[model samples]
Target: MTVKDLATLTPSGYPAVSLLMPTHRTPPDNQQDPIRLRNLLTETRRRLEADESVPADVAAAVYDEIAEAAAHVDLRQVGEGLALFASPGQVHVRLLETPVHERVVVADTYEIRDVVADAARRHRYWALVLSEQPTRLWSGDGSTLVEVTTHGFPFTHEGPGGTQGLPRDYGQNPSAHRDERHRQFFRDIVTGLTQVDALDTRPVFVLGVERYLAFFSAEWTAAIAGTVPGNYDHSGPHDLHRILAPHLAAYQAFEQIAALEHLDVARGANRYAAGLPEVWQLARQGRGAHLLVEEDYHSAAWIHDDHLHPAEQQPTSAPAGTLVDDAVDDVVELVARQGGDVTFVGDGSLATDGRVALILRY
Candidate 1:
């Protein structure tokens, strides 16, 4: 699913089901995916049947929808994880580029905290390759970059310096005319980008030779990650990915360092929370500006009087207060939904601070 889906998805009816699991991309390991899916389907049926709240028809329909969605999964192209969200009228099957905690939830709302967290922490960007023949756009997740071939991509230059040559009437200024035509072509590419919903809010990396890059820079004035001088028109996804991977790695490293600096400044200004409970409270009250979480930290807790109480295990049924299967995930969802920054830092980066931290807006 896309970042837009995180906000747009809703339960068409109650008793929505979310199934999530880590998946393998290749080899003998991926063969177990079907078996694992069948087992989860069985678990889902059990949970729905056991629940007295959900009506029989609704339960059966949701299960069937999920099953249908599962049957269509292209195991050959499966990524690191798979997520299925289904209701009586809604269904979305997502192949996650990163692994998420394996879990299922049946509730009135879709389980999207994991998706939100991934979108918040994992970088998504566009790699725009410029050329006279045909420009291309690629969408990148944390680990993979896939070509975007619809609507705004594979833009071929068709005027002036392209297939058509300059008229003899403008021979003295033919170079200038050619440059302007290329600029206009690049402008069309930018306009085309507007039609692509998946390209929203993603930083761009424009790659081309010096002149083409200059024309593009002159036309598009948005969040460009960087410019790489290259001829990627002939390069396939694998070749382009090999060229772009190191750049993304460096960007991620820079982002982590920048976030740590933000936290330090917040702590110095007395606008930081050091642990989960305090962060949760601040986040609930909308005080969170930036949430910094350890990559491996997860906790299950109970909410009592709006405060979190540590739970020995994730509660199946809440007999005491309200059970939170994963408070860390909840907190991440809370901060991100309110337009706050969320970063999953390396483990032990905040060990003394209980493996979690928050930079408050105040």
Candidate 2:
């Protein structure tokens, strides 16, 4: 599910559960995942039975939802991971494009501590390689691009098309018969676009020769991300990625720069905070407006005496409060739950100050 979708869920009362686990679609690992999940469900069931505070009916209802969720999981369709959230009446199962850590929580509210990822939050754009013969559609997240399918636009010849085959008097008038045929070819592409789902909402980058690209501007239905000039008729995924990377990167990089600018303005106004401890505090208080975290940044820390303490400095015995796997993850969950935004910037972007920075809601 998208972060925005998760944000719309209003918290219900006790026994709200979040289950995060790694699942495999291939052999050996795939064989073990279901077994692991079954074990976790058994443990959760036992814990629910042992809790005398919960009414029998309520516990049963919660267990039924969890069990139902488990029943829906298909080993054959599994991805690298699974994220399951179950409240009393609500259940959400999101199959991630990337793997997340195996963790489970049975708490007063859903545990979304690890739900946010760059792939999950980033704008998914499609690269359309338009040609008269084999129009193609690709899905990308600014890094990896994959061709999903190909369609045929209106054209008779099998080889790559150009104006060479057009009739001699084609350019005589704007409304000439051959000119209308070319426009009809572009119109067919628009029809193909509508048939494929979600092409209208997501931004699309078009790659084609100058003439086709020029015509597609008026005929295309989707919001165009950008156009790269070339006929990528024989280009493979790697070639397409090489051509599209700089454009997508240049567009996506704006987020980090915008975040840094906001930080500077907020800092000058005494509305900004840096460092894990301060940011974590703001997150807990629901004061986060925007969070800027360095990519792959993590710190082992836990709460102690209502304050955050790095795991290393704490006593060997269990800490007094929550033991978080990573404080960064905790902040992400908190800020997102509060309807704030999170940005994962490149390393060294926040290195001079702190690995994490936040702008306050106040």
Cα shift from native, residue 158, model 2 (Å): 20
**lDDT over C-alpha atoms for residue 170 of model 1:** 45
Per candidate, the number of residue pairs that clash is 0, 0
TM-scores for every predicted model:
0.85, 0.67
The lDDT for every candidate, in the order shown, is 0.81, 0.74
* Candidate 2 structure quality by residue, lDDT tens digits, 136-170: 77776445466665454323323213454544564
lDDT tens string, model 1, 159-229?
Answer: 87788877577446888888788888989998877566344666677788998888887777666677889
Candidate 1: clashing pairs of residues: none
Give, for candidate 1, the lowest lDDT window spanning 10 residues: 312-321
Candidate whose lDDT is highest: 1
